[model samples]
Each structure stands twice: as structure tokens, then as C-alpha cells.
Target: MDRSTGSGLSFAKRIYLPRSIGLGIGFMCVAAGLWPLQPQPWVWALLVFNGFLWPHLAYLLARMSKAPFKSERRNLLIDSVFGGFWAAAMQFNALPTVTILAMMAMNNIAAGGGRFFFKGCLSMLLGMLLGLLTFGPAFNPETSMLQLYACLPMLVLYPLALGWVSYRLSIKLAEHKQALRAVSRTDSLTRLYNHGHWKDLLHREFDKCRQGQHRATVALIDVDHFKAINDGHGHLVGDSVLRLLSERLALSLREDDLAGRYGGDEFCVILPNTPAVLAADVMERLRQELAEVRSELAPHLQITLSIGLAGYSPMQLDANHWLKDADQALYQAKRQGRNQVVSAAD
Candidate 1:
């Protein structure tokens, strides 16, 4: 469905429970207020329906509408209109009138913010005029003990219900944000860090090394004859090979190490607090592990990694310079043999 429809569905679901509870409790307040005035039989029946049954009908109306969000907004206006009518119907009893109007205002502002709030206020005014015409204008600002007691449940319970709904919505929003962040930083194929995020991490690591806070090694890894594999077998097999290598890399590295897909067929790793010798050993172990891994898609296929390592050095001018050392060493490894590890400091 479209964005508006999706949002409307969500809005309707979120408002459903609060509306039900609010209207139910509101029935009591209006009933007690009107009991003192002894309203006609039909008026009493309308109050019963509005209090006990209207919330479900309103929810159904929104859910079945072409535009649920807009329907819900209209429903809110109807609620405001009823609130005003009741306030007048009770002859403006101080406690019940204030209670109903205040609750309706809270609901409007929460549902649609300021613009909708003004619209709801206008609807309420219309309702009050209708109420005055129907009941004949009369004033009874007095609030009895019984009226105050009836108003208490709505005053206490409705805000609590609204607050609970707001809290749940905030939590869902936070989870969505976190998932988006992870997706943005990850490689779609390998599930490793993406090129941009990996490079950002390299800059941070380079700065730490430059400040004498830590030592680290950077490695660039390439699959030997990757193009030949894709040409001979197919891109699907090529993808499987890359995924295998990524799984091995994740399994072999320390928790502090970082690995990323630098670009198509090329991977990079950062080993924090590691020297060139130790980084080379780690790469050699990874290379050996992959050499033994057989693809389920192509059982006879052989996988090998040519890796280059560069340890942090005071002589390097910047992060790019450090990366260049690793790149050059990678070139040397491929030059010497297709499947081997080479260290720049060596």
C-alpha cells in the first residue's frame, strides 16, 4: 500500500485502545452529571451508546475507510463535538464539563498536534451550539460530591492510558532507527562493513596510532583468479566463494579486529594493537583455512587469498599513506605468487 494508507492503518490501531477506554470511562462521568438533571429517555439511551458502544464503531469506521488516518482524525473531531454536547447537556456542571473538554483537548493535540487541535476546538464549539439548542440554555456550575467521584476515574485513568501508548510508539521508533543504521553500514553480499564505513573506521584507527595510543596493522586481501572462477563457473559460484571467505574471516579474527568489503572482490582488515609479524601470521592462518574450505556449489573448486599487511609506523604521513603501504605489499604478494601473504615491513 501507499505511505498514507500505511500510516493511517498504524494510526488507527494505535488510537483504538485509548479511544475505547476513554469513551467507556467518560460514560460514567456524563451519566453522573446528567443524573442530577434527569434527562429524557432517548437522551439517556444516546449517552449509553456513546459511552459503551461508540469507540468500537469509530475504530471500525477508520479501519474500513479508504483513508484511515483521515477517518481517525474525523473521528477525533466527532469526539470533540460529543464532548461539547455533553458539557452543555449537563448544563455546564463545573467538574464534568471541565473534565470532558480537557480530556478531548488532550486527545486532539496528541493525535494531530496544533493544526488538528484547532480543528477539534471548532468542532467542539459546533457541538456546544447544538447542545444548547436541543436542551435549551441553562447553567448549573455546581459540582456535587457524587459528580466529582464519577469524574475521578476518567481524570486519573485516561492520561495514564495515553502515556502508555506514547511510550510504546517511542520504543518502536528507536528500534527502526537502529536497524537502519546497521543496514547503511553493511555490505549487502558479504554482510561485512561497507567501503565507506570501513574507511571511516580506518581514519579513526590511524589517528589513534598517530597519537601513540595504540599500534595496529592494516591488511588488504584479494581472491586469486576470481575473474576466472566467475568466467568458468558463473557469478553465482563467485558469490558463494566470496561469502565463504567472509565467513572464514569472521571466524578467524579477534573480536577487536575489523573487516570490510573494500570493493568488488577486494577485502580489507584492521587489527588493533598488532605488529606486522603478528598480522602476517593471522593472514597466513586465514589463507590456510580458506584453502581447505570446499564450496557446496562447486566441491572441486579451490579458494585461496593473497594478502598484504602494513603495521603502523611513525614515518607514514597519513591514513592514506598507511593504506598505500598495504596496497603495495598486496601487489608484491600477487607478483611473487597468487596465494601468499606479504608484509610491508618485511
Candidate 2:
């Protein structure tokens, strides 16, 4: 499912398009229905041509173009051009009471759906106030200020209701986007990061450490005699042991530390702003704690770990090279003894 990196509009935008178009169309349809009450035939024709048909056509053109919505510059251009054409269509004909109100409502709905809430609300209010000026005269050429007071209640309620609905929709969309991101980055088991998530974090942290000359460490921890445990006991106990081991690792590390399941029976920890010596000490303490827990939980089988530590240094090497050295040290620790800590050369 992976495509080119930085390739297109973020997934959130992709999901939002259909919802936005549906709302736009719904608002336009509402406007078209109200047209029969308007006194101007030209205004009804304009509403039919622009609010419903023309905007939908523009939306289709953009979809067919396949331009990513993430490009803000291009997106702005498209919105401006299409919006100008829409406004021109509305302004070309003489509008009436019902047509004006419908146009204002449709504009409010479209603007609120897209990221222009304040502008939409202000415009809706202004449009209604202007309706008082135009429609009031139609009823009576010398209509008093008292006459306009009757319409004020309905005018206020209209914008408030639309704003509330728009706000609710926006919040729901945001929650959906957040849930998608969590599912993409998180592992179901152990509740820690998966391989892909860990890799991205590693690269990001490495860049920060390199640029800032900030000390950081990577620790590779392998559960010793893991294959034997799986062979002697069933896979279920093996899985529990792995989860228990990770729980201990999570408890021992700092709040800023990133712990991930590298693969079966192996885990990696990224400790930001911690030097190699301190990272090694931390992992050693964790190893001792893990051994104690294993003794209490699974006395029938023994479990211990070997840890390899490597520090980040911009002057010495890049992120990949540092990780390679740490992995090599991990192999060395496994060769030297089952449960020990090994530090890589700077």
C-alpha cells in the first residue's frame, strides 16, 4: 500500500473530499428548491446554473486532474478561480428575497465546511442584514426599523444552527483521521511500536541528534535461550514471556525513551539525550530486573538478556552506521555470554 514518499494529499484530505462534495451538493439543492419563492426568474436560472451544476463540474475537473490537495499554493489558486466564477454567476442577475437568503445560506455552508468559519459566519450575517435593507423596501418603501426587528430572530438562529452542525462534522472528521494514524503506526501486541514505526522514529531522532550534537543511545536487547523456551513450552507461554519481558523494559526506561519490538525475541530502545555509558547502565539494570521477574513468574524456565549499546555522534558516524555497530556488538555479547552488556566502539 506504500506509494511514493510525500507523494500526494495526506490521507485525511482524501477521505474529506467526498464528505465535502456531498455537503456542497446538499446545500446547493436546498438553494434550488427555495428559488420558486424568489421574484426574479433570472436569479433562479443563475442559481440552477452556478450553485449546483457549475461547482459540481469544477469539482469533477479537479478530481480528474489528480492534483494532490496538500499543495497549498495550487489549492488556493483553484479555489480562488472557481469561487470567482461562482460569485460572478450569483451577482450577474437581480436577486429577490428567497433567492438572496438561499445564496447566503449555501455560501455559509460551503465556507464553514472548508476552513473558513469566521469569514463564512460574518458573510452570512452581513447578507442577512442586507436582506433587511432590500426585502424590507419590497414590503414597504418606507418600512420602519421596527419592521426589520421581526426578521432578526430568524437571521440569528440560521447562522448558529449551521455553525453548530459544521463544528460537529469537523470534530468527527478529526477523530477519524487520528484513529487512522494510530492504527497505521502502532502494534497490536505488546502495545508498542512496530518495525516500520520504529524505523521512522529512528530516522527522525537521528536527524535531530546529528543537527544538535545531542547525545543519544540505541540498545539492542535479545532474550537469551528464547528458541529453547518456545521448543520446551508451547508458543503461548513463549508469547506471554515476551510480553512480560517488554513490560519490564518499558518500566525501566525513561519517559522519553522509545521501546519497540524489533522482531521475535528481540527488542530495541532509543534513549534520547543519554550517552552510551548511561544507556548501558540503564539496560543492565533492566536485565537484572527482568531476570528477577522471570524467576518469579516462570520458575520452570530461566530467562535472561544480552544488551548492546551504541551512542549517537555526528562527528563519528551516521545513524545507519551507528545502528550496524550496535547490532554487531549485540552479536558479540551473545557470543561472550548469555546475559551481559556490550558497548560498541565510538
lDDT of 2 by residue, 1-346 (tens): 2222233434324323432443344334334333333536655564455434644554454444555343322333333333333333333222222333443435434543545434444544544445444334223223223323433433455445556656776898899899988878766677778778987888888988878857798988899988888888777778888888878877888788999888888888899999999888898898888777753345667678998888886655667787887798899999897699998863
In model 1, what is the error at residue 101, expressed in angstroms?
Answer: 1.7
TM-scores for all candidates: the values are: 0.92, 0.57
> What value of lDDT does candidate 1 attain over all alpha carbons?
0.94
lDDT of 2: 0.62
Q: Judged by lDDT, which candidate is best?
A: 1
* Tens-digit lDDT string for candidate 1 (183-241): 99999999999999999999999999999999999999999999999999999999999
- Candidate 2 TM-score, C-alpha based: 0.57
Worst 10 residues of 1 by lDDT: 1-10
